[model samples]
Target: MEDIPNYVAATFIAIVIAVLGFIYYAVNTATPGKKNLTSSLVVTILVGWIFFVCVQTFNGYFTNLSGIPRLPMFVGLTIVSIIILFIWPRTRAILMEMPITTLHYIHIVRVPVEMVLWWLAVSRAIPMDMTFEGSNLDIISGISAPFAAVFMVGSRSKSRIGATIWNLIALALLYNIVKTAIGYMPYYFTPTGGEVANLGVFYFPYVLLPTFIVPAVLFSHLVSLYQLIFKKDQPQF
Candidate 1:
């Protein structure tokens, strides 16, 4: 019974990954050249996560937050994934071609993610600051996503501009939450005995946030920004 919340959180994390994976598949398969790459990226994410769980690697690392504070493995994965998505011509093309509305709709997952984080916070699993009731304002982006997709996603200049502005706001919100999270961690330069520690996030299911969900969200936003900038001439329809 004590572990029920963990199970629930894990389930949500799985759903997040599954939904994002579906989007990735849809985007990749929408075009001729993007198919094979999906399997490889999916495999890499899963295998990397499997290794983390099997080794319980993060637990040890978190203890000495000053030594090398960040969850290097997951951070590396996210950075590499983002780099590939942005720098590789094939992936960049696929990202640019992915529907902006799809990207907006994908943010809806952040709403439930915020709920789960609040649940975890109430359980004392993580800091309150990570929740919407606290410093995390990312929920606004999620709650507004569907509306933005519906009303602000036309080929019209105003619509495109609206989407671009929304993306920028969402990016700022994400950055805030991320910085707040890291500050609460037992990391270098952070004072000891903060009001709430971020230990829970390093656990099995929660680790999925930094490893998978956050990265996916970042990728989506980046793709949106790229499309809004370089691909503006192409109609979103």
Candidate 2:
């Protein structure tokens, strides 16, 4: 962890903040009458989650090899929570109200995130398998996000087929990286020679990758898919 450069951490922090800021903006613009209430609720939940993860990370809760692996548990709970939120009527409505373009644009953050992972791998803070140099090719989703948003989601676009295909492909890419990361967890798989522990994500700032960033990106993809498949009246732009 100490071997990783400070700028890497700084860049990751900036990415997280940018993601949160865009989320707040999306909520505010989507919810007209209850924008304030909805935005506040969203911000509070995200910030609270970040703080909780920070406390646990600092206390070495996730790094503990005893009893059960807390990092996986934390990830499972966060994913379940996102599922529940999407299932709940009010929350679902708020998320569904957010523009498809906004959801698509949110994925641009993944580019910088992938870069940070590569940096961490270079510093031996995490296994190289988690980066583009290895098995993780999730950066493709980030690089193509803007083009998909503009071309496939334009106001005069005829069909949602293109956007739907892009969403599914991007979602698959997300799943690939996530599975790779979890597979390399110390409790699950031991690293061999010349490889480093995947402990970077269990530390400060990087902890947000699993707790906040992944969840946010996952949620956006899910919402976009739902909108594309079910929402017939959704505007192209």
Candidate 3:
């Protein structure tokens, strides 16, 4: 909070606008009966805002990995998960009626979570390795990022492959920009370093891109393309 001037006020205003905008979008685009856009918009904003303002607050440093403020995050997620459980007819019907597959679950969580993370990345609160500590945490994405790609390919969907591939390629391009901003790699690493650990290298997260995030994004889209070709846009009843 100290890092921000009047953090609470700024946060409140930002949230209000976002909520209003979401409501407008939902009201304008929601289908007539299936799920009211108004309601969906409310739920989405509630869940999303809670995650943004309460749950995932540590300035976006995933490595801060601390545990003090995660309750809001968990609670918001629980609420949203419950809503998904109830509203998604096909997925809901599957339970005993059938069974929702891992892929189904993935879409429910991944889509929102990734979108949020992306937003945070854009917001400096998350930091783009603007500092040493930040770069380190950012690197974690290097390993975990690829899982997104793996999931895309493994899902075996065809119709959506093109979209996913497009997304992956976009991520790669964005990652390079971020890496450069961080002063890592050929772009700039080791702003200062000595006695680097054996393999003790530390260009920090900025330089770790080749490691995780790059490929995950790349793979997700590639997988999407595959789906576009050989699979259905969504699951069959």
Ranking by TM-score: 2, 1, 3
lDDT of 3: 0.35
Give one digit per residue, the lDDT tens place, for model 1 in 43-132. Answer: 576666656653664455534456555575557767796887688887677777777777777888888888888888888767787898
Per-candidate TM equals 0.82, 0.96, 0.31
Candidate 2: pairs in clash: none
Q: At residue 115, give the lDDT of candidate 2.
A: 97
Query: Whose TM-score is greatest here?
Result: 2
Clash pairs (backbone) in predicted model 1: none
The candidate that achieves the highest lDDT relative to the unseen native structure: 2
lDDT of 3 by residue, 116-199 (tens): 333333432333342223332333333333453345433543224434553555455445544544343222233343211111
Off by over 4 Å in 1: 1-7, 33-66, 70-73, 154-158, 188-194
Q: Mark the regions of model 2 whose C-alpha exceeds 4 Å error after superposition.
A: 156-158, 235-237
